[model samples]
Target: MLREFLQSHLPQYLYVIGRPHLARMNYNELKIHILGLFEPTQEFDSLKIRELLSTDWTLKLTDKAVEMALLRYWRQGLLSRTRRAGRFQYALTERGFARKEWLLNNG
Candidate 1:
């Protein structure tokens, strides 16, 4: 489902590294990767975070992908969200931070 969604919504290529390969990220990994946008930890809407992650020119992400991941995180109590400026702003909760730490060390 994630791959299908990305293939549909994301650009055809990400930075074009001769022959780029998909990151092979699963749902948990992709959501964890999304945490990059909040590094140093701050709130951000789906669009803002999507743009930031997309700019990496390596990973491909769509705003809808981000929204889905974020909502999942929120539902799992991994992140906290608040509505701001007609959009949802998100920050890592304790669980998120811990998971991020583990990901950094293990991934």
Candidate 2:
């Protein structure tokens, strides 16, 4: 089931690269990749987002790095968050959604 899910959701190009190490990304690139993960109305916690970044995008980032980025976005009003079960659940704001679409389209 995991394999099937990966096959369905992961892009063909990521498989071709054999899991590239994307840790050296620039700020804008990192923002693009991270923001691209969310749907307009979807919410995800930090750990789940980190897992998706590692498994789907082949990014090897520390938990703190992801958390810091999320916090930054929250501060910038690109993300909204609420405390849930002792953790924060983050969702993209309208600005974030627009930015994600712009980045995807322009890149």
Candidate 3:
């Protein structure tokens, strides 16, 4: 019941944040990966995320693939871009943050 509710409501929230493609991802796995990028008051760099995930997950995806994923999420409204430390940073939108909290608490 709870999972059903989340599946319905959470996507709506995330869509508002710019992550329409999130529905296509393996939600649990993607959530775990994305949560690692979060910081209380700091934005995470996109390249760092790609590198970390590539190393940790042994993904070995090309830089273009990583950039495509990032851009997709950005277009979906799940992430926002900013400049930090002379690099492009990707931060979870409010909805993305909320979804992460939900996944953590409920999963």
Candidate 4:
């Protein structure tokens, strides 16, 4: 009896919960964009990256998205990740430099 009563009380409407989605750029495009940020040698946290690229895209960009992209590049040997200022900071790797060179020449 209790189970039947609870089922009837469940709102007769269906609600779909989801996060706001953006037209995510391809990883290679981000790779090129991020490569430009590296200097002789530089490290950046998620906040710094988001701030740098915020004006480039039309849709809203979040820090978490930047972090995930950074991590993906880092995993692909494009960026080196390390702990700095109590958080993970990233720098371009040698492979990243080579990729950057290719972009500069071919792009």
The top-ranked prediction according to TM-score is 2
| Candidates' RMSD to native | 8.1, 4.2, 9.7, 17.3
The model with the greatest lDDT is 2
Off by more than 4 A, model 1:
1-23
Error of 3 at 78 (Å): 1.8
lDDT of the candidates, in the order given: 0.64, 0.72, 0.60, 0.64
**Per-model TM-score on C-alpha atoms:** 0.70, 0.76, 0.56, 0.66
How much is 95 displaced in model 1, in angstroms? 1.1
As for model 1, its CA RMSD to the true structure in angstroms is 8.1
- As for lDDT, the candidate ahead, 3 or 4, is 4
lDDT tens digits by residue: candidate 3, 1-107: 22333344444433233332343444454554555366545577877777666543223356786677777777877678988778779888877777667775655
lDDT by residue for model 2 (1-107), tens: 32344344445543234655653655565576678777888999888888777764456778888899999999988899999999899999999998777765554
lDDT of 4 at 6: 20
- Predicted candidate 4, C-alpha RMSD: 17.3
Minimal lDDT window, size 10, model 3: 14-23
- Clash pairs detected, candidate 2: none
